[model samples]
Target: MEFVILTGLSGAGKTNALHAMEDSGYYCVDNLPPLLLETFYDLCDNSTDNRMKKVAVVADARSGEMFADIPEVISKLRLEGKQFKILFLDAKPNTLLVRFKGTRRKHPLIGEIASGSIEEAVELENELMNGVKAMADYVIDTTFMNPNELMERVTTLFSAGAHDTLLVTCVSFGYKYGLPPEADMVLDVRCLPNPFYIKELKPLTGLDEQVRNYICGFDVMGEFLDHLYAFIDYLISLYRNEGKSELVIGVGCTGGKHRSVTVARMLNTHLLENGQKSAIHHRDIWKA
Candidate 1:
């Protein structure tokens, strides 16, 4: 079983990391006592009905006296051949202070912080947590990163693949509505003849063959697809070498009712057929 032990300085984004791990399919436990570490693992292993579970434990100084035993326990666990990794989340002292002040929580190291001072408390905690931080296999700075950025990093590090491919997030939007701010590539399908204009095909979307043929009927359409395919291949090569986790591609038409939706669906299928890990979103489809 793959196990991850998560510990970090207070206000350094441990909770956020836990949330992200949960999203990435880790069975997460929050604020677990250090002494219970082996007991928990034993319970998991000894259960007759217990299935193989990927486990993550969020541990910190809040375990009070039990926190002192973690290092020895970790050492013992390693000697016994446990499969585990430790990720320590940390941030700048100033950043942690701001986060604490904004939330207004008592520092984990109770008597250390100067009375009514965020800066003093931050420095004191950093000194105390240094030993724990030193033992981490990976340390992440979360000062400027949002949840999505953190999650992307975790997924990229954990994904079962020999090569890291560019993650393309393709969203189909409508010009009448608004463009998705997150798209890395945007293709305008407004110039493609509107299948909505046709009385017979009005009710159907680009998922329909007739609408797809109509959109691809123009000579420019063929050229567009040819260049688009090449561009995607080039991007995959560029990003995999650079260790990029995800990419976003947006396909927009006038209403997102017909042509753009069709193209986005087709592109999604084409990418899959070419052996890419990809997903698609029709942003404005329900609106129309």
Candidate 2:
């Protein structure tokens, strides 16, 4: 189980960091009081779902006076051999001030600090957070970072293994058998030449080298693949940057036994070769 405690000054992008972690597959909680660290981990650990194991929680000045308990919880967790890392996000006072004013929201510590001024609140919270900041495994100064840049840095620090990869599932189905319900994108390769017309190729599925060769023999196949690959590549970049994790692409032909299977396999291979995780399923290969 990987645990990360995300803590920082308010208006310093803690919520943004938590959102990035969520997109990276972490089970995330926002504005958790410092004292609940252990209990939160306990609940996550007890859950049967593997997805629950990787957790990140935001614990910061938003907790009011209870935020001071951060260092104590850190010490306790360390003493108990509980594995976790702390990420502290911070920005310059001017940057933070601008952010707070731009957003037109009262600082979390506004009423708690003396004089009830947001400026004083920022300074006080900064002082209070110093203890946990000193204990942090990572401290990110997000003063000049845009949201995408911050997300990239946080993701890089905690990524298990290219964690945000868009998982691609390619399915080959015959038009006669109906479309795959799970498909997010569907392509019709029915326009492609059919290998089933050839006596030798007819007996072999797309898995056979001869059938693949026959399919590849046409000039149109190469052109079609080039265009489809380019189109999918662009679409994938858009989807991936937008935080989409899974894509089901259906390749269809008159019969799933040949062209559709070949096209889906080709697409899957293309994705895998490019370091993307992909799977191919010939849904109606045996329907013939």
Candidate 3:
């Protein structure tokens, strides 16, 4: 069993770190009380699912007073010969203040801060986390790291150990509706010949053989796909080099029912054939 106790001050990128851990094959539970550590471990160990064997959980100030005794719990886990590791995430107080302000989120410890200052709240949380931080097997200071950088750090520490692979999701959507808010990279396929203009193909979705055949019948499409596949293959390699566990690529067209869906599917199939981890979703395919 690989059990990790993730604790940190608020706004220290714990959420991103947990996502990376999840992508790296760790079963993640957020904001669990410290007192449940032993019980949770027992539950996971006794569970039949093999995936639960490698577990990482967040235990922190958000647990409030229940988090006060985490150091003792960690010590008990060690004494029992449980596979225990603690990762403490932190950031400069000023940086933490800036993060909270930018996100417009209230600090978990704001009530404890007499002056009601988020900066002071950071200081108080830092002071409170000292004992748990001292017990950390790894500590990440995210003051200078972006979300991707921070996730990369977490993946670096755990992904290899878990034999995890990078995950990629390709989404297809219509430009008329809106851009996908979650897309890490977006490509426009409006340059492709629109099947929507053809009477027979207009009624059919991109998944239909006739629509796909009509779109692929063009010389431009074949060339475009060749270039698109190569570009994405190269980019995926770069993302892997940076230790990113997942990447979201969006393909958009004038109407998602046709060109975008075909392109996204082609990209997804290309990735799989090239031995890359990938999945696809057509976001606006069914919409009128």
TM-score per candidate, chains pooled: 0.53, 0.56, 0.56
> What's the lDDT for candidate 2?
0.83
Task: List clashing residue pairs in candidate 2.
Answer: none
lDDT of 3 by residue, 1-288 (tens): 777878898999999999999999899999999999999999998999999889999999987777788889888987997766777888878889889999999999888877898888788889889999877766666765579877876786677553356667777889997786556889998988999989888989888989899999999988888888888889988988886656778899987899999988888898889888776777788889
User: Model 3 scores what on Cα lDDT?
Assistant: 0.83
Question: After best superposition, candidate 2 residue 9: deviation in angstroms?
Answer: 0.7
lDDT of 1 by residue, 84-104 (tens): 677777877777888888898
Give the range where candidate 1 is weakest over 10 consecutive residues by summed lDDT: 156-165
Q: What order do candidates take by lDDT, descending?
A: 3, 2, 1
- What's every prediction's RMSD, in angstroms? 9.8, 16.3, 10.4
Q: Between prediction 2 and prediction 3, which has the larger lDDT? A: 3
Model 2 misplaced regions, further than 4 Å: 161-288
